[model samples]
Target: MKMTPPVTGTLELAHLLTRRGWLRTTEFNTPDCTVWDYAPSLPDQLAPEQKGAPTAIFLDNTGESEFYFVEPATRTTQWNPYSRNFDRLEDLIQWLPVIENWRAPRSHEHESPMGFARLRAQGLITTSEMMETLEHFPYVPVDPDAKVPSLSRTVAEIHQAHNDKLLSKNEFKLLTHNTFST
Candidate 1:
C-alpha cells in the first residue's frame, strides 16, 4: 500500500485507524478498545485471550482469540508472537467502515495539534525538557511513543512523528511560567 507522504509514518497509522470509517464493524461494535501505550489497560469487558503486552502506541481489540493488534506506525496486521506471527486483515476489511483511502481533509481541528502542552501542564514534560528536545530536534511532534533521548514514564509515548513538527516559541512561556517565581 502506498502510504501518504506529507503525513506518513505514525500520523498516517493513527489517522487511518481512528478516522470516521475504517474499523471493522463487528470489531468496532465490540466497544472494547484502547489505544495501547505500553501500559496494561483495557475496557470493562475482556476477551478470554487478551492481555497487555509491550505495545508502543497501537490500538488493540481487547477480546480476540488471535491477540489482535493494530500497529500505530505501519497499520499492519499483527498478532501475539506466542499465538501467531502474522494475520491478514483481508477478512476484517469487509466489515470496515470504509475502504482505506488516504485523504487528510482540511479541517479546523488540524490547525492546532494536541500534544505535550497537556503533559507540560501536568508537570510530566517540563519546559526545560521541551527546550532540550528542541535543541536536538528543531521541531518535534508531541508524540511520547516517539523515541527520545530523555524520557520518563510519561503517559503519552509520543512516537517519533517525522511528518508533524511543532515549532512554537510561545509554548515555552506558558509551560515555564510556574517554573519561575512571580
Candidate 2:
C-alpha cells in the first residue's frame, strides 16, 4: 500500500504512536536509523496471538521508514530482519492496525550472534548500539518447540566479553548504564 508522508520527523512519529495507545518501551539510534519499540497499552486491542507482541518503527535518514511486528524472541537479538518497508510514514501509520493479524516470520534462525556480527561487519549497526539493545531489552521466551539459544545466556556472554576488554570503554559504559537503569 502507498500513502503520502504525513510524518516529518522521529518525534512526530513517536507522538503519533503514543496517541494510538502504544506505549514506547525503548528507543535506539544507529548510525543509519532510529528505532522506537512499542507495545499496545491495552492488550485486548491485539489479536490473541499478538497479545504482548512488540512492534517497532524505524526511521532512516533517507526519507524511508519501516514498521515491524517484532518477533518477541528476536526483538533484542536481530535488527528487525522481518519488516514491512514503507517509503512514506503515512503508509506505516495506516498499516499498524492491520498488523495485529500479521504473523511473525517463522525464520528466526537468522538472528543468531553471528547474524549480529555480520550486521556490524557490514556497518549496518554499531557495536555500542547492539550492546545497548542486548542490555536493555528483556529476554522473551520462545515457543518450547523452537530450537534457539537462551537469550539471557547470550547476553551474559556479551557482558563477559565487555569485562574481558573486547569492547571499548565507552561501549562498556553504555552497556553498564542500560543494565543499571533498567
Candidate 3:
C-alpha cells in the first residue's frame, strides 16, 4: 500500500495531549471527563460513511467537544462536537477538554450507519488477532523463515541516513531492495 501523508495537525494535537499527562491507553476516565485514545495508522473498521477509511480519531466523553480526527488524504483536522472542522490547531486548543470524569459519546445515533456506527461508539480499534496466515506476506523475505532487524524500521533509518548524506540515491535505492545486513 502507498504510504499516507503525515498529518502535522495530528502530531501537534498529540503533543498537546502528552503535555496534559493523558498518556496512551484504551480508556482514561476521571470525575471531570473521559478520554479514549487511538491512532490513524490502521485501516478503518467502522461506520458506513467511514468504511475503509484510513484516519485517526481521539475522543473525549465530555459534552463540550465531541471528538477530533485527522484525515491524511485531506490533511484536515475536524471536531464533531457540533461537526466543526478546523485547519488551525490554535482554534481547537482553546476549547479542548481538560480531561476528567464524564460520559463518552453515545453509541446509537439515528443518523449513523450500522457497521461504522458501532465501531465509532466503541472508539477506534487499536489491536486485532489473526490466527490464520496470509497466502503471501510481502514484508517477509522470499525465505518465509528469513529474519533480520525490522525491515520497515530499517527502511526508515536508511532513508534518514540517505537524507543525512551518508548514502547516495543509488545506494538508498539498492539498499531498499535488499534486507538490512546489520
Candidate 4:
C-alpha cells in the first residue's frame, strides 16, 4: 500500500489496518506504535494465530522498531509491507499512552502539532532528533508471544522521529505543557 509521507509510519500502518477493517478507528502516534506489542495487542486480537510468532528486533539511540507478523498455522514470521524490527515489542507498546496523550484529538484539547512546533522552536526536542525521525520512520512489530523486556528497560530501543519538527514553537509548548503537565 502507498504510505502517507506526512504521517508517521505507525499512522500509515494504522490507517491501512483501519481501512481494511483490521482494527478499530483511533488516533495513531509514536507511543501508540510503541505499545502495540502486547499479547493482547490489536494484531493478536485481530489474528489469534499470530500469537507467539518469532520477532525481529531493531534498535538504535532514540528508539527501536520490530517485526513479527506471521501466520500461526504456518509458524513463520512474514514481512508485510509495513513490518519493522525492535529489540522488544513491550517497550514500544508502553509508549502508546504517552503518544496518545500527547497527540490524540480531544474536545477540550489542542492538537500536538502546535505544541510540538513550539517546543522545537524553543529547541526542546532537539534539531538532530527531529532530522532523524524525518529521515527514517520509527515503528514496531507486535507478536503476542514474543519475550517481554525487563523492568529495568527504558524504551526497548530508540530511533529518530523528526516529524515533531513540523510543529511550531507555540504549538510545541502547548503540546508539552498540556500533555506532560503534572
Candidate 5:
C-alpha cells in the first residue's frame, strides 16, 4: 500500500496504478473526459464478490478524477466514497484494494463512464441521464503532449520566501515584479 505522493495529473495516476499491478483493460475517450478501466492482474487478487469486476478511473480536463467499481453483468457502478479529497497519496494507496473489492448494490443503478458509452451508442440513454452521467465523469480535455507551466527558479524562491514570512508583502511584491501573488 506504500506509494509516492499522490499525483494531480492523469498520466501520473495511470502510471502509478499500472506499477501496482493493475492491468489497463480499456480506455475510452470523448470530447469531455477520458475513462480508463483496470482490473487486477491476478484473479485471486479480487474479492470473492468482485471477481471479474473492473474498476474505472475518470479523469477530467481540470485534473480532477474519480474512482468507481463497475459490475460487469448489470453494468451497475459504485463510486468509491473514500477516494475523494484526500490529502496524501498513501490514503489512496491504502484504499486501492478496498475499492477494487467494492460492489454496487444491485438495487441501485448508478451511471458509469463505460455504461454511459454503451447505452449512448445503443440510443438507450436520455438527455437527462446523459447530463447526470457527465456530472459524475465530466469532460477532461487533456493534451498528453501539452507542457504545463512552471514558475522560474527565482520566482519559486521568492514565492517560498514569501510563504516562510522571510519577505514582507511589499518586499515580495517588489522582488517578483508584481508578476505573481499568492
Candidate 6:
C-alpha cells in the first residue's frame, strides 16, 4: 500500500478547515481566490451525508471582503462579498462548537478547560499528558510587542525588482512553491 503525501501549510489553515465542516466530502476551488467548500454534518466526526446532501461556502481569503455559500436544498451558490468576514482562520474555527451545536453557545464558555476536565473524569486523559503535549508542541508565537510588517512595502519592492527585469512570474511562482515545500 502506498501512503499519501501530507499537505503543507500553516496549522491555522488545517484547524480552520477541520473545524468548519471539512472532515468529510469537501470541494476546494481556486478562482481569483482560493475557496474551500465543505459539507454539513455533526461535529463528532467528519463524515459525509449518506444521502449525498451537502452545504458549502466559498471562502475568498485573498484580502477583500468577497465570500459565497451554497446549500443542499437550493443547489445554488450565493455570493456575498461584504456580509461575513474573518480576520484570520483561527477566529473562524473558534466559532465551530457553536455552529455544530455540540454544546450550547455561551459568551464565557471555557472549552479547552472543560474538555480536559471531562476527559479526565472519563479516564481517557491525564493532566500530565496534556502538559507533555503542550511542552512538546508549543503554539507558534510571533513577537507580540513587534510591529506588523507592511504588505505594501513588500509588494512595492517586488514590483520594483520586476520592473528592473530581475525575475519572471513563473520564476516567482516556482520560488514560492519551493519555499513552502519540504
For model 1, the stretches where C-alpha displacement exceeds 4 angstroms are 1-53, 56-115, 127-182
Q: What is the lDDT of residue 37 in candidate 2?
A: 54
TM per candidate comes to 0.18, 0.35, 0.25, 0.21, 0.31, 0.28
TM-score of 1: 0.18
Q: What does candidate 3's lDDT look like per residue over 72-111, in tens digits?
A: 2111223222122333445446433311111122222211
Cα RMSD, model 1: 17.9
Task: Name the lDDT value of residue 144 in candidate 2.
Answer: 22
lDDT of 5: 0.41
lDDT of 4 at 142: 47
Worst 10 residues of 1 by lDDT: 102-111
116: Cα error in model 5, Å: 26
Q: lDDT per prediction?
A: 0.29, 0.46, 0.33, 0.31, 0.41, 0.34
lDDT per residue as tens, model 4, 1-182: 43323323555555543453333322322321222222222122224434232222122223233442221111224433223333443544554332222211111112122333344457776655443222222122345233322211111221111244454455345433443344
State residue 69's C-alpha deviation in candidate 4, in Å.
9.3
Q: Mind giving the per-residue lDDT tens digits that candidate 1 earns over 30-62?
A: 333334232211223334554422223223434
**Compared with the true structure, what per-residue lDDT tens digits does model 2 show for residues 55-100?**
5555666335443333332323445544445555665665555443
Two-way lDDT contest, 3 vs 5, winner: 5
Pairwise TM-score winner, candidates 3 and 6: 6
Model 2 steric clash total: 0
Model 6: per-residue Cα lDDT over 1-182, one tens digit each: 43323223334555667675564233464533344434432122322422222233345534344333322111213321112343444444553332232221111122232333344446665645432221221111133221221223322433344454443465334433432222
> Model 3 — TM-score against the truth?
0.25
* Candidate 2 lDDT score at position 86: 56
Model 2 lDDT on a 0 to 1 scale: 0.46
